[model samples]
Target: MLRLASSFLSVPSSLPHLLALLLALLAPAASAMELGIDRLESRGFDSLKGKRVGLITNQTGVNSAGRRTREILAKAKGVNLAALFTPEHGLDGKELAGKYVANRKDPVTGVTAHSLYGPTRKPTPEMLKGLDVLIYDMQDIGVRSYTYVSTMARCMEAAGECGLEFMVLDRPNPLGGLRVEGPPVEPQWISFVGQLPVPYVHGMTCGELARMLNDRKWMSAQCKLTVVKMQGWERPMVWRDTGLPWVQTSPNIPRADSPAYYVATGIVGSLAGLETGVGGPNPFEICAGKGVNPDSFSNTIKNLGLDGVQVRPYTAGGFSGCRLVIDPKAKGDLCVLALALLVETNRASKPDLFAKSPADKLDIFWKVYGSTTIRDQLRQGTSVQKIAQAWKPGVEKFREERKPYLFY
Candidate 1:
């Protein structure tokens, strides 16, 4: 047993100044992360002062004080807040992933809201006719499959087509802005979910991504783009380190840790054709499909020496499967859990969860993973380590290519 006082650094009361300094050092560190919206407000939202402004945001588009962006803009002095737009989730952030949300009026701001994820993904000429500028402020995970970036890309193109300006109030990339993973999407596999030819985990905020789209000509057309760079955000900080409240970006991602799990198991649920807690509070973390025994699976996985994650039998209310813990103790990539899960599950034989062949289901599976070859390799019983090795070259090339556009 260890004594509590053994590791203590003693303070000297005889040296009063030194004692005060020690106390200060022991205090919790304060965070100074001001969001882009907060900075925009401080500057008096000057860009929208005399313009007919159309805002594309959701419930996650709020400031540090938890005030909705449109509410503040609609009531701000000198700003002509015209209309509102929403993406895959409605303005409320209640809609499920891949489901189309119908356009509805916002009760708070009383603006005519259009559903961009519905009938027309890209804004129509009518939507842009009277607007001088389009401002977008949506919180997004730094993944290619998430539709928010795709929505922003379309809006930029539409604004350019109608001769209007577009601006993005940057948000933090929750996965941080350093690691780039997975395969670069081929042109033929491009869809609403994965439009840009980036990896599954492209580590850039919305503003940076918009700039890349314009510079790289990823969008159909280019607009006069402006990015409101976030103050006090660094490239190395994750969401928890930023000290801001975690607003649910979607019904599925209810907490901060959920996005990481989604990257690992969400696609597994989709390809396997199982219920991934769509309406429930917790999603993507549930291991309740046609699963093997919890104890056996967990022991085997733990013994495999998987990096950056631990698995244990989770049993509650007659349900049992392993909980894939993003093991904080391990000095390994946090994404290892996702990669290892795919590999382990692929090796084990179980009931066929896919109603059709994975090739037939590439339309859905390819959204997140962004490669038909990955699906085919899994089908062919290829090891996950081998697959990762094959993709390492592409991942390295992308990291260098995206360096010029880094904004944190």
Candidate 2:
């Protein structure tokens, strides 16, 4: 028995070697592929074995190989995938923007799909009563006011109330993780759109944000949490780096450039007469308000010497709206791009540009871009760079405070 035990400890690791070889054989051949829940197959569903799971996901919650979480978990070994929950876009992502979802069975999987939007923006006790775990896997646009994160936070609270474990199967932030920009939301004015004082473009993954919210007690403090971290993802690589295909998480964000332009031009979504390219090829890429001075705005940015971006002015016609396309060929820094455009807009247009309401634009800016510095700068003729720099201290402080929660 002693000799057998010695042999077992010394030269008898065939099982491990075989497992390693098998994994190597199964190793992905390509880079930047969609690294979603499908990767969890070999990682095992043992944590959820025999437990009913409620999944909150949307059309973008797909594996690199193009499989949905619902389909994957339904067939996953030992996982009793019970219920399906959806955010703004509905379970299949067919609903149009602002369209409320009603509880219904998934026509494809026959699983009960609950709407976490509309009059009730959270999961109720009935939804959690039979579930052992609640999993979230939506693609976020990297903006604070995008609503997906809010849904995640609300669900976290609901899961905690029912003693259910919450799991975040993270995907990339789409805008990448290196560039944290914009101002932090003020806590006093916190709304459903802006919870937890995160920036408009917080450079952390959804999983990291989930942990931060829990740590900050922005959500319930006692919720059980687990995050499935992404492998091979680094901060420098944007969605383009992930080699993952772009899935439009919302109607307006048609492409990766939409968020790129979002930092600079999306605030224009709040200005009136600007069509905002909602139905066009590039949503945030196009901005137009009635009586917008396209030539002056263009010349203003040209003189800013802001490195890395060029905006070409054009008219979208009556419904198309006069707009600017963020020149795809240009490249440099994002904030510089934003500052240049903002300074130019303020110089070329009236304070009325900022004063316009929903008839003129969307509802995102009054909340996300409500920085006192920027507002005062526009009011006092301060340069956009100066305005942006004024907010940098706050941004730096947030970055330092948020470091502990970063997974990468």
TM-score: which candidate is best? 1
TM-score of each candidate structure, all chains considered together: 0.88, 0.84
lDDT string, candidate 1, 1-408, tens digits: 246444343434446776788999998777687888888999998878889999999999998788999999999999888889899988999887768889788899888898998899988998777999999998998878888999999999999889999999888888778757766787877888798888887778899889888999988789999998888898777788788889999888888767676766766665653434556666766554344566775786677675766666765555455676663223344444555655555444364443333664547676666766765677777776687777778888888888788875
Which model scores highest in lDDT?
A: 1
Off by over 4 Å in 2: 1-29, 32-36, 318-351, 358-364, 370-377
Instruction: List candidate 1 stretches off by more than 4 Å.
Output: 1-29, 273-278, 303-307, 315-320, 327-331, 334-336, 347-362
Q: Which 10-residue window of candidate 1 scores lowest in summed lDDT?
A: 327-336
| Predicted structure 1, TM vs. truth | 0.88
lDDT of each model, Cα atoms only? 0.77, 0.73
